[model samples]
Target chain A: MNLFKLAWKNITHNPLSLLLNMVLLTLGIGLISFILSVNTQLKDKFEKNLADIDLVIGAKGSPLQLILSSMYHIDAPTGNISIDEAKPFLREGHPLIKRSVPLSMGDSYKGYRIVGTDHSILELYDAKASEGRLWSNLLEVTIGSVVASNLDLGLGAKFQSSHGFNDDEDLEHEHGTFVVVGILEPTGSVIDQLILCNTESVWEVHDHHEEAESAEEEDHSHDDHEEHDHEHEHDHAGHEHSEYEHDNHDHRNDMSRSQLLEHGEKEITSILVQYTSKTNFQALSMPRNINENTDLQAASPAYEINRLYDMMGTGTRALQLIAVLIAIVSAISIFVSLLNSLKQRKYELSLMRVLGGKARTLLSLILLEGIIMSLLGFVLGILASQLSMAAMAGSLADRYNYEFSSWQWHGSEWYLLAASVGIGFQAAVLPALMAYNTDIHENLSDA
Target chain B: MLKTSEIRHSYKGTQRFTFPEIKCDESSSLMILGKSGVGKTTLLHILGGMFKPLSGDVSINGTSIYTLRGNNLDTFRGQNIGIVFQKPHFVQSLTAEENLMLAQKMAGNSVSTNTVHELLQQLNLDHKAKALSYKMSQGEQQRLSIARAIINKPGLILADEPTSALDDENCKKVVELLEDQSEQLKAALVIVTHDNRLKQYFKNHIELS
Candidate 1:
């Protein structure tokens, strides 16, 4: 009874062809939407976790890996740098430096990282304790909201940490068990997956480990040293301990073990630095100075992540280009189908003319068919993209502790809608014109 | 009333036709008989407003239909002229009733489903109202074609060899159906055909020599 109703009938008249056109269009649109959603979320997570850190001074290694391990908590650390080597950046009232938080990351509980740092990290994440209170002792620990929920840990729960960043519970440091004192609120950042403790607990656990290993070494070498040489062996062990202490000192005399534990641990993994101001000159010059002039390596999170983006952008751009190409090809397929159907419908169009149907009426009918087809395809495509995103949500949560929601409407989708409608309109042009200019007499007479 | 004055038409690189002028009153039927190449269909097209004669005018009722241009001409044609094309071509996707409704719609007239259903009932096709046109039998399709033509209640009815492909019995039935519908609606009926079998159906006949 109506043009649109007529168009719907015509499109449904050949269901297989309609399905073919819709599938091609859906695949193209679904791929593009998937890429857009992931790309937007990834960029958002990176920018958020970067969180105003200007430089990361860690042991000499790949700057990208250092940023990944410190800022993203996804990669292995670049060995360890002594606190003495990293002290200049963390000193009180140091020029060109606003604040720095040193990290000691050689442990994980379950699969979640157990980060050793100061309270400044809590301030960096704007963290609040939802249960109990922040860690106040050497062995007390505070778990992030995600870590607490994922591991099902609660207040007063005690768990040992593995020796390194690996998830193996067999390598757990049995000498010390960290007691959970607090659980943080959900921050929606990497902090939500961390178990935060002070650096002293990490040093103490490793120190006990080193003592156990040294005691076993003495048991093995007792026959070679004899009873009189035991005193000499004590002198040698004291010398070795002093040498280990000197690794963290710069010729300062009369240093205590507590001072060593506080400001000069034999090793701290990395330091997160913030400049005094955005316009500070050292932001540009300091990373270069440290990488070339000091034993430590400095990395700017922004620069390394941009490099990551550029590398990722190439693959994404290629995929996006392929998606666009598929869309264009589907448009052509629509055009071909329209043209083919027009040929078969010529006499029918002429019959409409005989029934007083205008040329423009026929033109509009064909165009309306194309528009209807495109609208159906667009709706299906959006649903397909959402389904794919939902399928990917679980793994993304497991791997990056990132949540992916499929319910958001992207602004880019408007452009996609326009593109689809435009393609439909464009594809209908020739067939509509052919229908418009049909010779009623010849067609009716021929039939 | 229907009238044509000095109508003529031609195909590019083919034959030309100069048609004889004719006139018919309401409730009357006229048959245009011709041989295979006499351009009977072309003359029908001209009278139905499907084509503009190279040099002539066709007036249905008091208005010169050829003088109306674009959609105005289409609207006039839809309101005043009904055409039954040979072979009963239709929008295959639509049902018989819907086709009639479409004719009324395209003519810019308000579609009345009651009127369509009533006409199909009177034409003995009410049982097949929802059947697709291509799925109908030959006799049923021809009747559906007649229903579509008379759905708008036009002042003139034009048929282009509506009975050419039928047998003697169906051909006579189709001719009677056209005449009866035209008389009932008080419209001038015109049939263009090369078939001699319809020569006895109408007394008002024009021979296209």
Candidate 2:
């Protein structure tokens, strides 16, 4: 009997057309909502991972690639920088630098990179071991929370790393095994997917791989050099060669393992640097000087990530524009449908007028129809976006180790709802006016 | 009670119509008869307060209905005038019973579902009350329209060509229903039509030229 009930009934009267209109609007709003949530999550995770670190000094290569690889762990390392060449920045008492954590990465277990880094890097992520303790010896490792669960490597679990970032069993470094000494708390950053160990672990595995390759060469009759004589003793017996023989061979070798571990021309993948104070001019000048004069590349995570965003912004903006265009088209569709319904209901409206219903009463009934359609579309659109986000959550987490939840509200959603309702109002206004100005006498007498 | 005097109307490019004065009292029925071009519908509209006459006055229940303007005029019309058009019309989406309730609501009258149900039963349309307004048979729709017209207990009931589309039996039944409902509400009834079949049914009637 009420206008609202009447309006609802009218909408349902032509169920197919109203449903089509609602679906059009739902798609428009759903697309924008989906993009808003995903984009916000990406920016949030990027910003969180970029926290506090002033500079990344890595091997000379593309500065963006270096930042992406060394800091964000999403790309390959530029190259290795010799420790001798990076000594000035690594020194504890360096005036401009507050701390530096050295990282050497060339190995991975099941696609999760094992990062050979100083224990200080754990502090950078505010990470603490959830079980056992941090790595204290070469090849002893602490796994990130996500890594531990994904690989199911608990405390005291042992696994050997492969030669590079791929999961190739052929390149396994069977000569050395990394034991899980600790599992870190979830930091929700790149740290959550890393295996933390000391820089010496990287050198130990690669060095042993080198000697094993050399022994294979000797086995193929490539050389009979004096050094090849010691290769037979520990050829591939799971690194169980005699300790006395290892010591004797170490003395006879060009450079012993212990000597190489203690500063004999070793290389590290990158160094994460922090300044004494953010406002200090050295923070800016030091990176500039290093990029200009040295064999290393020093990049700021903030600058590189912002540049990435600019490159990404064009695609996002275009999509948002398309979403807006869809909404406008939906508004036009709503306008046409309402006008048509008004035309079809002209006789009924004239009857109402004859029965002493005011012009405004008929107008309100039509207007209520428009508002109901838009509000229904809005609710359906929001639910669709959330369901889609829930579906994507698993894949995003699996691939990037980043979690995305659709339940989180985006700031733009309220504005989107308002715009949708406004479009509904705009669409209905002309039709409502038509109903309001209905020539009751003419229509009734004509009928 | 309802009365009209000096009512005249003209549409653009159409002949002007000056209607004859008429008066009818409570609990009575009157029919205004005319052929196609005599402006019987126009006079009905003026009497119902849906259209303002070129120069005329219409009063129902001793209050000048046309003196009210805009919303107040609409309120007065809604409260005092009940109209049934030649073609039965209802908000298509509403059921038969809801159409009556809507009439009461639009007239700013308190709606009682019990009254609506009882009216439908009395009109022999209780079986059709829950049916979609457009889905009912022609006779059922006509009765429902009559039910809606009397739902607000208006002082005057106007019917425009109500029996024009009916057969002899339906036409006679419709005239009796209109008179019976108006009598129950004590409202003066006026039927405007071009049909001669209704002449034998109403004693107090006028023919428009």
Candidate 3:
């Protein structure tokens, strides 16, 4: 503790130099902590939620996007296929296809990416809502923690989709509105950045899209009268269309048994399938075979994640190596400073030596000085890192759909602290040797 | 009381000293006089345990003090023996008070303001307590050095060229301070110098050849 006070006094005594050194040190440590924490948080999230699902079977164009979207909820999914096209496998139901969960992406509200998936997304992943129950009707949405916090949304809150990918475009989704029925807990994964609704909501939104646009135009012209703005023009456009089919939805729940045969491509973005286990390779192979032979393509999730890691893994490791090098350089700086002070403090050293101070005592004092400085530098590093994390929270959540926890010491924080202190103490070796020898007679003769 | 039995020391390739038996009894003063390079300073340093003689035995109060080596020797030197050098170097960062305090702390002295103040006033350095040694005049700095030497009230007081840089008046005052401290503390005083001015103050003197 006295060593810390002395180092602190020395640093504070030269405020300008101290400030310059601190700024450089903070930047170096700040960048390292940010990069390491982000990587760690991502590794943690992937290792947590993506455990059960071995491979993602989807209509894959870019296998990485397919995995990132269906598995991590980040990308825009590839187009959807027919349940008739989907029905063969649903009926085949190989043991490998433990359960197939269909996902209809491409629907969004405001800037929130909405995944039009069935309740199986929650069931397969073993996630539960903290606020309200799952979506029952079409046009209903379930928000995640980040979504709720960022958009100020909650259960029973209404929202309208923007035109593009998670952007608040001037034009809203032509469908009426989506009422938030549930809010998921903070999973600290990509899912927390999304807005989830039923697949039917996606279907219904497209169904009334053209009519909603036409009706909106009519209202704009009719708004000159200022009488019909409160008439719920949006609700009526989408409500009438659903009402026409409401009577027959129960019968049409299963597409193979549908009474009315629809025309054009049955609109769907993609289907995400999970297997019971890798041992059920026979069942999992059936879907891949079906997709390969049929219209859709089933890509493996493990392969995609591994490939993504391969693509980014090199650069990340390189950056981490650079951080380690910078830290080593900092340790060397400590060594140099301590070594310099030893020469200037010769008289002081001899004085203490003459006062019954052991050589080991002086050595510990120098070593303690280095450890204290490194620990202090590390503290400043962590603080700077957290501030950077906060600044990047929103954009990171939106882009990669990754969430960062508020800065605090975790299980491994102590390991980092210990490593820094060890580096500091070891760096003191050069100076420690000087103090250990101290040349008692040289200083004494001069004295 | 102090005694050196046949001490021998050499420097460079040629300089040598072979001292005969020497002694300083309790409550007495002894002066060793010689020209430059005649081992006057070397003998003083060896007695204070600053350097090891090539061959010799030194005893203080009948104890073989040479057995306590290195830093142990240093502690014994600070507490039991006080040395006044031809040139005294002070830590530039410390003030007059701090300078005295450092020596006092090393000697385990009580750090009494009265003792420090009296010493400062006797040396006419009371106004410079807060002033750094570098800021003081040479006479005042020499006086502070004397103050530092006696701060511990050591058993053996050794002074070398203590008056070399002083005016006659200041030299008399410095010698008076030394004489007063030696008697008050009942210490063995040994002065080594080429200066003849201090001959009048001491009763026992050795003219080194």
Candidate 4:
């Protein structure tokens, strides 16, 4: 009876053509929506984790890799930098640096990185303990919110750190058992996926591991020497070996925290430096100066992330172009289907005029049909995008340890809605005009 | 009540049509008979207010239909006149009942499902009310067409070759239905056709060309 009802009826009259048009439209809109959401979340996460840190100084390698490893925690470190060599930057009261948090990483638990860092790292991300308290002792650990939930590790939970980032039982360190002391509130940054402990814990775990290997080697060498030595010489070597074992035991058990850090060639993965004055000349020149003059490399996270985006933009642009092309094709399909239906329904349209319906009524009916189809397609496309994103969220989090919210609405989707309706209007104009200009006398006379 | 005066029309690159004057009072019926090419359809269109005459007036229910233009004329026609065409055209997607409701809605009348049901019952099409219009048999479609034409309760009903595609039994049945409905509404009825079998049925007749 109403124009909307009439329009709906007309479109539903040919179910196959309607379904085809709707499917094509849904695909186009869904792809565009999916891409937009992913792009937004990626940019959001990168910017949030960029934080107040001005530069990352690490062992020389790809500047982008240094930033990814140090700032985003999604890549392996370039290598470790000796703490003695990095001492000037890591100094507590250096004039150019407001704060420096040194990272010593080469350990993980169940694929989540265990970052051995100072408490300053929490202050850098504005993080606070949501449960218990921050790590103060050599073996006590504070977990990020995501780390705590993912590993189901609450306060007082103890687990041995794996030697590397992967979850390998053989590589699990036997020398150190880390007890979870605190869980940090979600900061919406890379910090949310890290486990923080004092830097000495990493050194202690690896130092014990190396000492064990060295003792095994010394015992093997003594056996070989015994096969070639006189009894008196072998007895003399046995006395020296026990003396060396006694010293090694003392070295392992008696070293204090300060002695451990200041001992021969201590190393850390990276130094995350925040400037006292961000816009000053020293802050601006620091990365280039370090890259050119020192053995270390300093990467600006902002600069490197921009380059990353530029690299990703090309693929995104290509996908957007393809989605647009699909949208155009869908519009054409709408036009073709409407025009074909108009041809078959010419007599019916003319008959409406004979039934005392206005010419504009017929015109609007056609327009309404197109608009209705496009709106339905748009709704379904949005739902499809959200559902697919939700389905992919688990794997994406497993890979990047970043949360991808499936149902976030973006402003651009409004523009997409308008564009969809515009496409529908454009497609229906010709058919609607044809309906408006129907010749009642000619059409009715023929029958 | 319907009347026309000196109605005429012409299409581009076609012959001009000069139509005879017509008048029919309330509850009366008139048959305008002519072969094809004589503009039998043209005269029906003018009387139905679908065609503007070259220079004439068509008045239904004492209002000059042609004098009203554009939407006013459309509204006037919808309120005062109902039309049934041969071959039983419909909004094919709608059911038989919905098509009847559409006529009432388009005519700017309140849609009364009761009236639609009663008309379908009178036309012997009540059983097919929910059936898609195009799915019905030819005779049933024709009866449904009559149901749509009178759903708005117009002052005048115009039939253009209404019985041309029907058989002898169906043709007689359709004309009688039209007559009976027109009498019930007390509306004037006008039938334009080339069929000679209708000659014995009409009380008043005009031949064109």
Evaluated at residue B28, the lDDT of candidate 4 is 95
How would you encode candidate 3's per-residue C-alpha lDDT over A1-447 as one tens digit per residue? Answer: 133444454445345544544554555566678777777776777767564665555564776777777777677776556655665434435555666666677757655677776666776656679999777666778888878987798778987776546575666765568899889887655667778776657667754664565567676785443334423543553465476347546543322213211312344565666666776658556546766788776777667777877877898888878777777777777677667666666776665554334576667767776776777777898898888888787677566656667575555667667777777788787788788888655675554
lDDT of 2: 0.83
Lowest summed-lDDT stretch of 10 residues in model 2 chain A? Answer: A252-261
Clashes of each: 0, 0, 5, 0
Write the residue-wise lDDT of candidate 2 on A322-387 in tens digits.
988988888898899999988888998887876678989988988888988888988888998899
Q: Which is the better candidate, 1 or 3, if ranked by DockQ? A: 1
Query: All candidates' lDDT scores?
Result: 0.84, 0.83, 0.70, 0.85
TM-score of chain A of 4: 0.88
**Number of the top-ranking candidate, with DockQ as the measure:** 2
Q: Which stretches of candidate 4 lie over 4 Å from their true place?
A: A207-261
DockQ score of each predicted structure, in the order shown: 0.70, 0.76, 0.28, 0.73
TM-score of 4: 0.91
* Candidate 4, residue B180: how far the Cα is off, in Å: 0.8
lDDT at A429, model 2: 94
Which window of 10 residues has the lowest lDDT sum in candidate 4 chain A?
A252-261
How does the DockQ of candidate 1 come out? 0.70
TM-score of each: 0.89, 0.89, 0.81, 0.91
3 or 4, which is superior by TM-score? 4
